[model samples]
Target: MSSEQLAIRIEGLSKHFSVYHSPLERLKHVVFPGRTKGFNDFRALNNVSLSVKRGETCAIVGQNGSGKSTLLQILCGTLRATEGTIEVNGRIAALLELGAGFNADFTGRENVYMNGAVLGLTRAQIDERFADIEAFAEIGDFMDQPVKTYSSGMYVRLAFSVAIHVDPQILIVDEALAVGDSRFQAKCLNRIKAMKAEGVTILFVSHDVGAVRTLCERALWLDKGNVRMLGDAFSVTAQYNQFLFEADNEAVPTSAPKQIEESIPQENSAEPPDAQQAMKLHRPINHWGSHVGSIIEAGIFNQQGERSSVYTAGEPLTVRIRFEPPDHADRNTMSVAFSMKDLRGTDLIVSTTWDQNPTGFAAGNGPLVAEFRLPNHLNAGDYLLAVALEDRSGVLPQYYEYIEGAHYFSSLTEKKQYGTFLAQVSQSVHA
Candidate 1:
């Protein structure tokens, strides 16, 4: 790619740190000057490479301690890479860890000027944009107070406002947006959208799957200080989510005895459903609980009473869940529930058996079967299902088993619909 089109470039990037047992070991290493240094070398980033084009919005996503912060610090020059090369063609502003660049004793106004100067702005330049920054921050009189007195949200607001007003060509945001309230988060997203439209490149790091898919065109998935996947945001996030599900399932302790099994079978009113096809399209299945019970099978059936993974818009649908409860389970107050999420990872609908009987439910003494009539009129799209069983007998409910991505299905349509819902329309001409 042409140099002008490249906003950031990294090659063979890596960061390493010395892991010492204690301060004594570190001091001993300094005195002895041995090859081992009385510590182990920990590689936080390993041979990572990626590129971002000017004006493109990109994201870095992963579980905690996956080298995400290290990579960003290297990009922002807050930490030096132990190996490799990095290139930046324009001015960069970053909102990293909380209270990273501000002095606690300095007033917000003073910090603003100091941060602006650090970002390559002169006193006159800061003065010209100071009013706009203050207005955007919306902290009012807090600007005159010491930053130490500011709440976490207030600090984020002022820092974000100052960073944006400095006319940075590249902006890096690390999960600091979580500190802001919903309204402020919305405002920040809108401002970031406007900045993207104005040809500013953005590097965002967030755990919010919806935000990552909506705002970024591309994503980089990091794992154990290595690049696991890098591609379109939707595909990357999908893979990342599946990875999380599998990881969680694996994290369940195997010491518990297997006391539950699938007792009921899915109905066979017609030809057998394609299990492999359904598995391929559906999100990964994850379960967790005390192992008192388990869901054996989950199926989606059309109005014809035939199991299927595809449906038509506005068609009647049913979700059949068969679960096996061990003898230790509480039968009188147990409940089953399910939730549906769209492709964007947004929960569109959720329902529980307790909705019909608020007090509780008694499943009697046989295998449990839950059949829920799902609402029609969902917009044409793919959706994933999550199911769980819980006991509501006491003040604190206990989950027996909660399985995520239990089923996946799609609603097809001939007519174009906007958003995730197809609303019935009726109108009359007044003129």
Candidate 2:
């Protein structure tokens, strides 16, 4: 692609740090030169390459030691890469470590001008935007106080306010927004959405998968000094989540489940319906777990026990999940769960069989079916379903079969609903 079409481009980027055992060993190494070897080289990033278009928003996800911060620091020009070339086409504004560029001795107001100057804003520009920054920060009297007296949330509020109001062409955030309260975080997200709409290139680092899927178009998953996966936000985050789940359980399945045919079976027949027929797996469907058991079929049905994908508000609904049971699997340790999520992938409701049947159910020779019945309290919107079969025998639950986007449904109502769900209310007002 042409240089003008891209906001950020990197090639063969790498960073290495030298580790010294002690001060004496470092001195010996410095004094002896070729005679002494006292340090080991640690690579934080290895030959990483990426390209982001001018108006695209991308997210970076990884564990603590997975080089996520190192990559961001390099992009923000706070750290140097040992090898490779980087091209950043536009002016960059970064929110890295909390209180990174702030002077503790200076009041919030002074810090604002200083930060603005550092970002290449002249005194006139800073004066023109100071009022908006102050109002957005919402620090009130604290704005006149030294930063030393400010809370963590206050620091993030001021930093984020200045970073956004400066009219940056490129924005880089490194999880600093997580320190803010829920309301402030929501406000920040809405502002970010506005920025995205205005074609500001954004690179966000966050552990919240839901946020990544909701805000970003693409995501990069980093592992120990390497790129594990890079693709659309939803698919990349789904794979990352599965890796975490399996790693926590420390169990690798011997084999994967057999793929089912695409034909749908009769509801009254003994055979289970095909998963593909219940919902359109338009995008990739993620299924991962031990091969001991698997979800053969899943569907959402109405009160008449007929398959349906659309429901009226307050109507009765049933979710049926059919799966094979592992041989000699412990009944007490096995459980089934299903969750409802909005189209954006935010979880709205979750129900588990183990919550009701703590003692567990009996083992059967044939395929077992679990049905979850509940009233449709969801507002008028499209939704997705996720189901899982887990074995809780160990310290961490081991998933036997976890299927994401197993089914899709929609709810409709004549009355306008306010939020995600409709809550039952009984009220009387006195004049």
Candidate 3:
């Protein structure tokens, strides 16, 4: 059913768990008249109400202990809610937490068949799609080995492969999808979308905002066992990001900070141009992501896409930055900039997020491209293209560094020294 039609209805759902004490407390409850009725209680689900129509895909998102998992469990009937009611119509295949239904002792092939049966698939249906399942898993010969030996990634792939092959009308995926590599994650996302297209009801859950934005039409954000926001992905994600940034930047000390320094020395007697062309260059290849950190590949290009080693007193040049992130991050942003400097570092042309194209990027993937284009002309001798990326969110990077000279090209193009930038080069020469 689509969002327009009701597939499943949740009514005032709530689940609570009681903490248990020592054996003495357990005995006291059984015996005396004055049994103290007190123990720590946790309400995992609280007054959550929602409806899903047939052929609809919905997502439940929240931070740890925000009751998202509890809600999913209650919907699947694996765990009964303490308060509300859940109604399920057609058959459902759920991929919850890792190895939820499989026996560790069983081989991957065995668990696939066993889990398939649990989804009401007969031997024939599973056999028909067995090869498809195997290929989807990508686990290779390890399928014959007991699952206890499988890595977390291998387990998730196998489990997901079985869950999708059963052809259930409703699919519930918890955070289990995050266990696979990028390719497998994309594969699973596509299959879920396909199921939605075929009119199956799907529920997906993840803390990743990027994945949520790309996969779901709507989102439900839960905080402290309550729905914090329910709306479009972009709006909700922006709200969450704002909250995160505020928390992280609260204590950025003003004392002894890593200052941004501009050093450009100048005023030397004119000398003859070098016999060899004054140029700067570096070839960027597999130098994208590193365990330690990154460097930005910034360059100046003409309209025709040819790069010059040097520019005249004023000439046309556009700057492009190629960024690569480290292996992991909570949140990150990359900033590329250009400043007019002599041999010493002086900030003649400095612009950042506040001025031009202000953008942010997340880490955990491969190369990310950030570009900045400027209009033609500049009075330039030796200017440096400073390319740098910072989390700006104040999160310290585990493996982050600078690539000293990302790329350097001169703007020896002709111009009169009027404005600090090339914008006035033509007017200066004419005057």
Candidate 4:
């Protein structure tokens, strides 16, 4: 990418703070500065470097106190780095700390104008997009109420609404969606999707691994004020999750055979079962556990029970999954389940053996098949199927094998529908 196409560039970035043991030490340092050793240097960021291309979505993830927040604050110009050379190419709008820029005494509507101005929008521009912001926030008459009286969700709603409406070339989000309800979160995600399509550069930070994997193309894993890994979102997030599961001080292997240049998505395919399959383009971001029992094969079947990667909406669909059991496996403790989610990571349907079919399985002598049937009520779109095998005999449930993006299928509709769900309707006019 050309330099003009770079949204952000940084080299040797670091931040340090001087910490004093007590008030006496602070006073001594001021009175007899040269004679006293009163402060210790605490490094929040240490020699970090990264780049993000224009219109790309990148994610920063790490444990608490790992400088993820500090990095975003520096990018948004809220905090200054102690040592670094930074370059930015466009206007930036950020929702960093909660109520960071809002005036608690002012109403939500008043803060909208103020925040928009801070983001480099004129009064006229704010006025033009005021309605859109309000609608997107959906806080109702709360817009007229003082921000101090608003709840956490209301605060985030107004904050995110203003940030997105300012039309900045770069947007920075720092775990703001965690405050909103599920529906509001989905709305915000959809809005983020729209912004990305318009070539808006995004820098997101969140503990929600699934959200990070779904929204970001590239990921940067920060460990103790240092770069742990930098590569494709799925790859980095998968390795980070493994590290968390281990919870050991030793670092997990993060090296990949090939790095994805500029974090572009990879094409994926699944072989057809019998008949010729349609052009199936998308690939599942598969991450599995190191359990003894593993998913050997997973397939999508049509009404005629033929393997397919595509199906029509309102038609019969089934997901047939087969698993290989480990040696001396206790089948009585096993449970199988699956869930379907749309492209945006919205959970559409979740089915489990305990809820649907609670049956004990045979021994580990042979392969086991778990089939799920659906009425095909999903709207026309791309979807992913995730399957899990759990052991529920103990006090705490254990995931024997959990595979996501295990299979993918597209639903075709005879008539265009609006949302991700399909519902039957009947109407009659009275004369």
Candidate 5:
């Protein structure tokens, strides 16, 4: 890509810090150049190179101490690189730390002006955006209070609000949103989505693999201060998750299942099944297991036993799953599980047959079917279904097949719903 198409670029980037044991050792090393060798070199990042295109959203993912923060610090100019060249071609707004640029003694209002000024905004520009920033923060009367008295959530709220309202060309965030409440986090994510639509370049660090897959088009995985993988978000996150599962000694699928072309049969229906819905059931975003068994077909059905993806609140819904069993496996030691998650990947409900039946049940060797029936209490929104099969015979439960994004559905409600799921309640007046 041309230089004009790139927002940030780095070549041979590296950062190293000198570790000193004590103050006396540091003083000794400074005073005696040749005799004292009291410090060791710790490399935080080594020969890292990446380029983020203009208007592209990219994510940085890894465990702690993996140089994620170090790289972000360098990109934001909070820390200098030990070696390499860097180029950033945009007006940058970064939320790298909590209250990073705020003065504890100053009120939130004053800090807003300071942060705006640091971002190359004029006093008039800050004035123009102050109302929107204050409204987004939702700190109410606390906006005029000293930041030192503010809670961690309040601090992050105000900081994130200011960062977004500044109209930055390139936005950088480093796990700052994790401190906010669920509602506020959802609000921030929506705003980020809006920003991405407006062609803003975004570089964020998040451990939430679901968020990475949903928000970013590409991902970079850092491991031990080196670039482990950098590619499409889905593929990179899949590999990363597999790596973690293996590191924990968990059972992961050894091989991909044979392609099954059969569609989920709709029972007692006059119309044929939808091809798109049928395709999604077999194409899970992330699939893993021991290959001992696999879900061949799955779908959501209505009361009439018709395959449907849309349902109304308080209606009967059933999740049907069919799987091929491993040869000679004892049916008494098997379990089936499924989870319902919202678009942001929050688990609204999780159920497993093993929870009720510890010993499992007896079944035949043919394809096994499991059906989960429940009232549709989920609030109005789109959702994804994940399914898993496990072997309980071992000391620890070993998953035979785990499929994420196995199916998609939506729930509609006429009553006002406040959260992920609706609750049954009755009101009584006593006066």
Candidate 6:
């Protein structure tokens, strides 16, 4: 059989949870098995079926409570499936949680053997791989100390290093790959790549669609315990993201959300998907903010209307904002503002263009752009350009975007620090 030949098969899989009352209900269960605690039961996984072939990298994705972790736990045998069947033909190594299976009281070396043997490695096999695992973990002298004494970073290092070197035929990895530092994450990702090269089948689960897009060939998306999609990683991720927005009301803008699993279509269904063949980075998705008055579209450009990919510090970056009024405004007043913020949505810029400079709008819809030139003496980082047209002026900015990490640029050269939005300055040398 080819590497793509079936390594694992799933059919009619599902799981459910009790509604909002699981905690009280669990207590009741211990006291009274016959009487249920809550009026409604939450169905976590509904009829879901999927397949994975040998040497394939498959990812599971969804928002919280979307049954992603539930499915992975079932596959890892930590949780029993409420229904359906899963079949696999391979020796397996699983990383279901961060720092799982290690006794905090035990040393790293002891936990390594315990974890290795749980994967069915013989003592000799564990010994042979032990040195490599230790070096990869890079915990140094801490390996001899109890795990509880280790930092969270150290815990992740030891846990991840032990799991990867077991040489299993199939690797089931949850989000544990994200626990360590960026450099360690790069290292672990490289190892996953090496495993893929060596024909190891992998089933990965993560909320990080970027990592899933970068690592996996195919993907499965679950929503409220039912299988929403099983297709190319990008396509399924997009659908999963849509459900995430629907599930969370606070997940505003709908186009983008925090830790969003944004996606485009995959170029191929049959071959293992590569990130280059996965999706276009630029998205055509339009956005709407909380607005009594309306601002429909937002776009980025230069003054010439031609789009340029690269912008230098202290140069000019222009953004065009489009809007219209449903009815004639009594005041007919609005504000268009731009802010530079990090990915976390923290306010880096408390300033707006309209407050300082003036732009006028007539009754109906028209194309209007507020422009700001890049100042040279700024930090290097990514930023979002936010513009809005509110019903009222200076008081309350109603129609707000917080456009969710829209425009991003980097410093061509980093002289001192890791930051965006360089400080605006003027010179008056000790005269």
As for lDDT, the candidate ahead, 3 or 4, is: 4
Q: Compared with the true structure, what per-residue lDDT tens digits does model 2 show for residues 1-431?
A: 99999999989999998788889888988888766677888999998888999989999999889998899899888899999999999988888888688999999999999999999999999999999999999999999999999999999999999999999999998999999999999999999899999999999999999889889988888899898888777667877888897777575534544654232222232222222433453322466677623677776789898877799998999988887776666777888989887755667989889888865568667678899999999999878788888886776667887776777788999888698888788999999
Q: Best candidate, TM-score-wise? A: 2
Ranking by lDDT: 2, 5, 1, 4, 6, 3
Give the per-residue lDDT of model 3 (tens digit) for 97-143. 98688899999999988988887888898899899999989999999
lDDT, residue 130, candidate 2 = 96
- Each prediction's TM-score versus the true structure: 0.74, 0.82, 0.59, 0.71, 0.71, 0.61
Worst 10-residue lDDT window for candidate 3 reads 283-292
Model 1 segments beyond 4 Å from truth? Answer: 1-6, 20-36, 53-56, 122-125, 196-199, 217-224, 227-300, 306-315, 326-335, 354-367, 380-417, 423-431
Per-residue alpha-carbon lDDT of model 4 for 1-431, expressed as tens digits?
67898999989999997799888988998898777787898999999999999999999999988899999989878899999988999999998878788999999999998888887788999999999999999999999999999999999999999899898899999997899999999998898989999999999999998788678988898998999888777657756765665564234332222222211123233321110121143343544344623566665678787866678877888877777654555677778778887654445798777665455586548777788887788888777776777666766445556655666778889998797788888989999
Global local distance difference test of model 4: 0.77
Tell me how far the alpha carbon of residue 273 in candidate 1 is from the true structure, in angstroms, after superposition. Answer: 20
Q: What is candidate 5's lDDT per residue for 129-220, written digit by digit as tens?
A: 99999999999999899999999899999999999999999999999899899999999999999999999999989998878867998888
Which numbered prediction scores highest in lDDT against the true structure? Answer: 2
In candidate 3, residue 239 scores what lDDT?
52
Cα miss at 34, model 6 (Å)?
Answer: 4.5
Candidate 3: stretches off by over 4 Å: 1-4, 26-34, 249-431
**For each candidate, how many residue pairs have backbone atoms clashing (under 3 Å)?**
0, 0, 27, 0, 2, 12
> Where does model 4 exceed 4 Å of error?
26-41, 131-135, 138-145, 248-287, 293-333, 338-350, 358-367, 373-386, 392-397, 404-431
Candidate 6 residue spans exceeding 4 A from truth? 1-4, 17-40, 243-365, 368-431
Off by over 4 Å in 2: 28-35, 251-284, 302-317, 324-334, 342-344, 354-366, 374-383, 391-398, 408-431
What digit string (tens of lDDT, one per residue) describes model 1 on residues 232-294? Answer: 776677667757755755654423534433322222222212223334634343445656246
Measured by TM-score, how close is model 4 to the native structure?
0.71
Candidate 2 positional error at 232, Å: 0.6
The predicted structure with the larger lDDT, 2 or 4, is: 2
